[model samples]
Target: MVAADSTMRMEPAWRVLGCRGCGSAIVECALVLAKIPYEREEADYATKEGRDRLVQLNPLAQVPTVILPDGTVMTESAALVLYIGGVAPELGLVPDVRDPLRREFLRWLMFLVAAVYPTFTYGDEPAKWTHDGEEELRRTTDEHRKSLWRLVEGAVRGPWFLGETPSALDLYVSVMTRWRPRREWFAQNCPRLYKIALAVDADPRLAGVWADNFPA
Candidate 1:
């Protein structure tokens, strides 16, 4: 469960556009957990208009590009999560700078974004990593990601990544479960993380977000 902060203040409306089931969806999840008001635009990666709009906003044509209340455009899903938490300190989605656990939170968060998340990027398109032996590259990256996730599994203290309370790390992991080797493989190889994914999946507050991003 997530800790609630009824008094946490939010900015006006923030606009976000991203493809559902992509990394951008994590940004939406963060906003939801932070209880910030937002509008969503679903980007269709397969279409030219969607790609053009994303590229126009971000230049990189990446999902999860957010336009803030003040009309500042922000990208990078992890940084966006931190930004939301900064404004709504009471949300507890991110650890405060003074909190001791803040270091641990950052450590895992970076590992997921910098280390684990890239595996998918390279694995999905092995040619990006190498011109030849694409299959081998994918295989190696997949195994590498599994081992990395095993380490993260051991870092789990309880139901959530940071124990009883859900944090940005948990939300990030929840979305990652749907990628790479898929959730079933994660469940078998990394039971602790799989449990955290289930906890996030069952969270009532996140139900609408999940449905919006990962609809059946």
Candidate 2:
């Protein structure tokens, strides 16, 4: 594991334990966009030691495990995104409770994490789930994931997921597109989401997080 910075040494800052190129990138980008001070510990789940460390903090050994300043532990990308938005509402990553888009935002956000994200969880390593029809399971999940993306694409507004303003939903599109079916597929099939991903990739606020997690 590698320490991204020594911010923890000087003050009580948020600490993120995650691996590069993983879902943790979503949380990292949220922190950066919120202008939150944080220290990152690269926890490569593929390695035994890294998995052990993460398991200690989170029994599930998930990436994007966050250590709050008050020593509270937080997991799940969507939850962390919401927490950051609450702490830094001025960032506008989450729509206000009164915003009309608030309902749509909440709707799709849960859809992504609950309905879509699980495809990768089970499909990425089929053998872990079962020994039978591993290849079939992967193919089915991939197709299912693509169908879910198409559903999201149909709902996308423009310039961002919710029409004009960017939000955590856009952040999710930006990161998840880089996985599985690949960006090439998205460009051809889900043009709106593809554009949002490219826009997020170019956002100055998240340049460092993108570079570290998805180096050119």
Candidate 3:
């Protein structure tokens, strides 16, 4: 998804505590690309001590906890994107809270989180998807993800989801969908979304995160 040698730079005062290759990590990826001043602290989420401290910030104990210098702490990657974008609305990286697209954005964004991602990222087991077998569940998840990607692929009637400018949603989708190169699996089936990923990846604004622990 990025040039081989690309990198993300951070400034002091912001700390992102999480893994390097998780979805939260991808949000950190976008934050760095936006040139937001911050640093990452990879925490052992599986440990009780780490889990306890993380829950203090986010009751759900989600990864990617952001602690600001002013003692403000927030979790949930999408909400974090909104918070950071709230600080720099001029960047147009986020839609307005009042803007209808903001709702549309979150609706689709969380769908990616609640439905699309977990389905694809979880264990390949029958129990996970209520299917009779692991192979069946895997097939079902893959097909569902493919359909979701296609839905998003068509949602863009304009250059971006909103029509004129690229958004946090754009950044979110790009990083989330960037997986191992599978020309037919993604490039061919999800052409429009794939094309958008390439376009966003090419922007200097986003090039900041091309390096680091992003997926290949």
Candidate 4:
């Protein structure tokens, strides 16, 4: 709940390790949606050179690492989300940073990463990652991915994941949860999150990210 917990008092300098057409970039985009100030460092995930830089910060070579002004260099998209929200908790971008809420936040965020996130990007290639789904598994994985999206769509309670103000989760979920080539799936299925995604798109602050990734 980055949106619900961020504060108006803090204004920290930021640098996000992001990429094109990926989850990390989407979270960086979400920071913009919440009016969080940040600088962007683009990474080409498909290239080895990109992997090398990300290895220095995060061996996983993932995107959405938010470099804190204090040089925290936070990795893990969800960890970065929590870190940024801590700088300005009043903004409510994440849940409370040090209590029952913190645990709850991590629970959902991890579920998204472990269960939901993989179903999207890797849905097209489960065989490569899992080995169990060799040969012709993409079709099944894709179908499962869509089924997961339907679940995500149903989870949305309103204009945002938790409520009115979109949180860090919304950013990640919106981009990752999109229906992909099935563009209208969200609307044809979970009308609510689809509308939520549309609202996230309409946000002017997020223009930089979309322009850099899904550009016209």
Candidate 5:
């Protein structure tokens, strides 16, 4: 139940319920990059208390569950990214509807959330999904994830996932590369994406968000 700065005279327009070091950082980064007004609630799904709180907002109890200013509940990082982009198209975190790269943007965005993210969902806690061969499941998923990263590496256009322009895809690459398989593996095998991750990490707009979600 950690609150945002109470000293502010006005309430933040958005309430983000997310755990630090989790996928929620994507939304947090977006908000910060867009200069949107928001407050974050630490909803650590690993603990019963955190799960209970998130379950109230989202049945799946997922991190990055967002309560919109209108009180609408939003989940799924991809959807949230799109929504944030819609709200702040000037930031260029999402390609314009008319941009040629918009198609590729949408394609890989779905690829990440639909294809790559599930590997972590299932692999991170094999016991939750299966009663047997947890080790095998983790290993299999890790290999599969590596293969997926290779696919992404091939698609990357350089400087960012979508070429010279940055998008939410860059944010995904930035944060996710820090997860399983680790930065060392990404640096060796996915150099293009590794460079993008490093760029995103260095963005001064997200310095505070990155610091809080991924400490020194």
Candidate 6:
């Protein structure tokens, strides 16, 4: 019943632990849009203790793990966006349940999570997948990821993913373009999506968060 209580602002604080450049940046961006009070703890997934700490909170040992004020833990970037969007409807990050674009919102959000994010999770460091042909695998995955971005570029409707207003979908894509082969490649291959990314990057609501998460 998150949507039912969308207008209510709870007093509890929230803390998310993850690397700034990772998907956790999406969660941080959503929190800023929601105008919710929260803090971030930078965790280095490279170290043993760092990995162990994340595993302790989230069995998956993933970044973007949120510690709710009530001692409850939350995971997954998409779910966090939905939850925070519900908690703060004034921001328009989450569409109304009855709105037709709601379906589109959910679809693109899941698409980013299921398809786009995995590229970095597996492609950026293919050695984690197998030692025999890591180089080839990385190259293949990088190309596949670029192709996926092109598909998304064609799907965008302009100004934002759902059109006119900003949403969690745009923010997700924005942070993602900053990774891997980098934004230059994306700009050339997926011009439309690259524009959406730039718009999200320059959004007034997200301006501060973007600067903090991605410094020049």
Query: CA lDDT, every prediction?
Result: 0.84, 0.90, 0.66, 0.67, 0.90, 0.81
RMSD of each: 3.8, 2.5, 5.4, 5.1, 2.5, 4.3
- Write the residue-wise lDDT of candidate 2 on 144-164 in tens digits: 999999999999999899998
Ranking by TM-score: 5, 2, 6, 1, 4, 3
Instruction: Quote the positional error of residue 16 for candidate 4 in Å.
Output: 1.9
Report the Cα lDDT for residue 118, model 6.
85
Stretches of candidate 1 exceeding 4 Å from the true structure: 1-12, 128-131
TM-score of 6: 0.90
Better of 2 and 6 by TM-score: 2
lDDT of 1: 0.84
State in Å the error of residue 166, model 5. Answer: 1.0
Instruction: List model 4 lDDT by residue over 1-216, tens digit each.
Output: 123235443655567777776776666765664566667777766678887887788766777666776777777767666766776677777877564445645666777777766665576546556777644466666777677767666666676877666677677655764446354776777787677777877777777677776778
lDDT of 1 by residue, 83-148 (tens): 988978898989898887788899999999899988877787788578889999899999999899
- What would the TM-scores of all predictions be? 0.89, 0.94, 0.74, 0.78, 0.94, 0.90
Q: How many backbone clashes does candidate 4 have?
A: 22
Residue 47 deviation, candidate 6, in Å? 2.3
lDDT of 6 by residue, 95-170 (tens): 8898888998998888889988787788766888989999888888888887887778877878788888778888
Q: Tens digits of per-residue lDDT for model 5 on 1-216? A: 223443443544788898888999998989887777788888899999999999999999998899988789999999999989998999998999999999999999999999999999999999998898899999999999999999999999998888888889999998999999999999999999999999999998788888778888
Can you tell me which runs of candidate 5 are displaced by over 4 Å? 1-12
Q: Which is superior by lDDT, 4 or 6? A: 6
* Pick by lDDT: 3 or 4, better one: 4
Worst ten in a row by lDDT for model 6: 1-10
lDDT of 3 by residue, 1-216 (tens): 232223433323577777555566556656665556666666646678777878878776667788876778877777787777877787777777777777777777777677766664553345645655777777777677777777777776457766677777777667666642333466787776776677777776544455555546
